[model samples]
Target chain A: MSRPRVIARLDIKGPNLIKGVHLEGVRVVGDPNEYALQYYEEGADELLYIDAVASLYGRNNLTEVVHHTTKNIFIPLTVGGGIRSVKDVELLLKSGADKVAINTAAVQNESIISEVSRAFGNQCTVIQIDAKKKNDKTWEVYVDGGREKTGIDVLEWAQTACELGAGEILLTSIDQEGTRRGMDIELIDAVAKMVNIPVIASGGVGKIKHIKEAFINASADAVAVADLLHFKRAKLSEIHPYLISEGIQTRKVLGK
Target chain B: MTLNAKTISILDYGIGNLLSVQRALDAVGASWTMVKTPEEVKLSDKLILPGVGAFMHCANTLEAAGLNEAIIEHANSGKALLGICVGMQLLFDYGLEQGRCDGLGLISGYIDKIPDQQDDGSARKIPHIGWSELFLDEECPLFHNFSHIPAAYFVHSYMVIPEHSNHVIARCNYEGADITCGVQKENIFGLQFHPEKSAQAGLEILSNFDSRI
Candidate 1:
């Protein structure tokens, strides 16, 4: 098994970094690139950039940010939001993003997943599923940055997306998003068990222990932190050591 | 061939992350040009083939662009040539993705999908995305200054199986199945991962490649 990745997710609106609670009540953080560079220096395994308002605007706005980030940062960068067609995938990939995560467009047209995967290899395509718990054993899928509920079962959609050729699953829990509590361990465990692809748990990382719990209890292959890392509550430098001490494998922190 | 030689050529066949590779080369302070035509391939001191797409389509594109012959001719002339990801797979004799497709045959090997199931009958994920440690099986100059590189980021479903075991320079263990991660045959080299996107360790590898030319 590969080491669990520690990814820093940056939710962007235009050029500024934004954060929200339960995927609502948005506020600016700072320049997206500045945080991205800080995370990169702090030994983030990968970087995820989502244009939080791209779908609402009907087009992606993170291309320039992606282009600039790729020029400066060397870690794997995944860009999502408003990825509607093969051309959109092409544009982002050309802009230097290693992978493109699609949610809203993918739920609308499932074939878009296969199309992008076929054109640019399955590894280049990621399916982002914003899920909210419906009951004890079910979660409803959401699109357009968790604003629209699709009523699709999270497990069912994840399996279908994997079958359709999504290399990885970026599973974000809406109920716990921006709550600064902890990741939905049940949600991550359920999806991680169902899908063979790497599942990145996102949306509810409060402390360093939460990250470790996501990997240990949830069986997540990667844990993505936005509020924890973005707001300066938890540093990746500190997180890596804590994870290593807890017997979880992670990439060596550079310049230590 | 001095160690600090700056000029490098990256083949562009209408696919792959050419700019990322260019940015990496730039970060290493090595001058590079995107080689689109056959003439540019001939004029380049070293060649880097960077790709991120299907195997058959990339092979078809190389044939359509007449890059296949150019790459082979350049390799025959003893100029250093490196292939990244699907670019690395294209250097093989054939690729099994989307049926059997012919490759550059620069190295005697074939590209095939990584085993879907591990030794314990557990499902192994396709694409094998994320960082994995590289166990160097052979000595090569490309790994110079690699003491600090614990792992390089990998994002691929298929891997190359070289016919000659000696050609396999490095191996990465994926759930007990040892997969070939690097191939070296004389001046020809193939890396299954994206060094350009693999942080500082990746930059060191790129710098090593630049120094070899």
Candidate 2:
């Protein structure tokens, strides 16, 4: 078994990462650059910078954020939000981002995904899908920072994105976001079983066991956690050993 | 006659972020030129091949740009040639990344995907991102300042399985197999990981190359 990759997600609002109860009221957090380095030093596999307010602002500051993060941290960093065109993708890459994630833009224009993939290769392009459980049997895909309901099927979107050359899928469950009730494992399993590309399970990780479940149950390549790591409830050292015990491969945590 | 500074020509095949590779070279006072032409390759004292993206795309672009002949010519002259990441994989005979893509064939090996060593059979994560320690075979001049270092950035899944084991300079533990981290064969050098982004360890490796080349 290969080591499970750990990616820390930095949810940005304006210039800083913000944490809120659910997705309603938000409060200012610390400098994103500082948090990013902290994760990098902690030996995070990769860093994800998602502008949570990009759709609200109608613009993303990923270029500036990526430049700052890369200058200090040498790990692979991915930037997402408001990435609409190939030029937008190129700008993020030029700004020192290893990969650019597209969500709403990808759903709006499917061709953009193929074009970016063709131009930069699949590795540099990732498709993000925000999903919400709509009924007992179905989940609806959300767009525009998980604000608008696309009403598209999750399975269909995941397959389409992969076919269009999305290297990986960053799947975030709206119903599970900030709930800390653990990930929507069923949804993840459904998507993971469908897509050939690696699926990174985001939104709803509260404990160490939850991370293990993500690997064993959901079949996620990497788990993206926000509040758990940010709140210091789950340290890398603790998680590393726990996952290894459960027969999951993870990078050995160096002495802290 | 006093010798002037040697120009390290980096092969540009429309694949990599040359600026990052160039920046690393510049930091160590290595005079380099981003060469896209065959003439520039023949003119260089040292050569670097930096690549990103698919193997076929890069190989085709290099052939179209006449870099293949230039590289062979340069290597035949016994000038130092270093390949980074996919560029490193390109030094082999062929790559199994997507299809049976032909490589430069300077080394007798083929690039293949990292198999999932896990019993569950779900460990085929494409990009093996992040930093991992490199275990060296023998202390060589290429690692003068970076001996037995346990920290270096790695971001590839496909690796070269050399026909000759002596060509392997370094290996990193991943999944089941000892993944190839660095490869060296006389004047030809290849690294599966990015030395530029490997921080101090990377800098030291480049420094060693600077002094040796």
TM-scores for all candidates: the values are 0.97, 0.84
Once fitted onto the true fold, the runs of candidate 1 whose alpha carbons sit more than 4 angstroms away are: B1-5
Local distance difference test scores for all models: 0.89, 0.79
Q: Candidate 2: list runs displaced more than 4 Å.
A: A21-24, A56-58, A232-238, A245-247, B1-13, B22-46, B94-102, B110-136, B139-163, B170-181, B197-213
Model 2: which docking level applies?
acceptable
Q: What total of clashing residue pairs does each candidate reach?
A: 0, 2
Error of 2 at A159 (Å): 2.0
Worst 10 contiguous positions by lDDT, candidate 2 chain A: A19-28
Native-referenced Cα lDDT, model 1? 0.89
Report chain B TM per candidate. 0.95, 0.92
Q: What TM-score is obtained by chain A of candidate 1? A: 0.98
- Number of the predicted model whose DockQ against the real structure is largest: 1
Per-residue alpha-carbon lDDT of model 1 for A191-254, expressed as tens digits?
Answer: 9999888999997899899999999998899999999988898899999889999999888776
Residue-by-residue lDDT tens digits, candidate 2, B1-213:
212347677887777866667767776777777777777777777788988777777888888887787897777788899999889988999998778988999988999887744445654455565556678855666787554334677666577899898899888876555788788888999988887776556767877788875
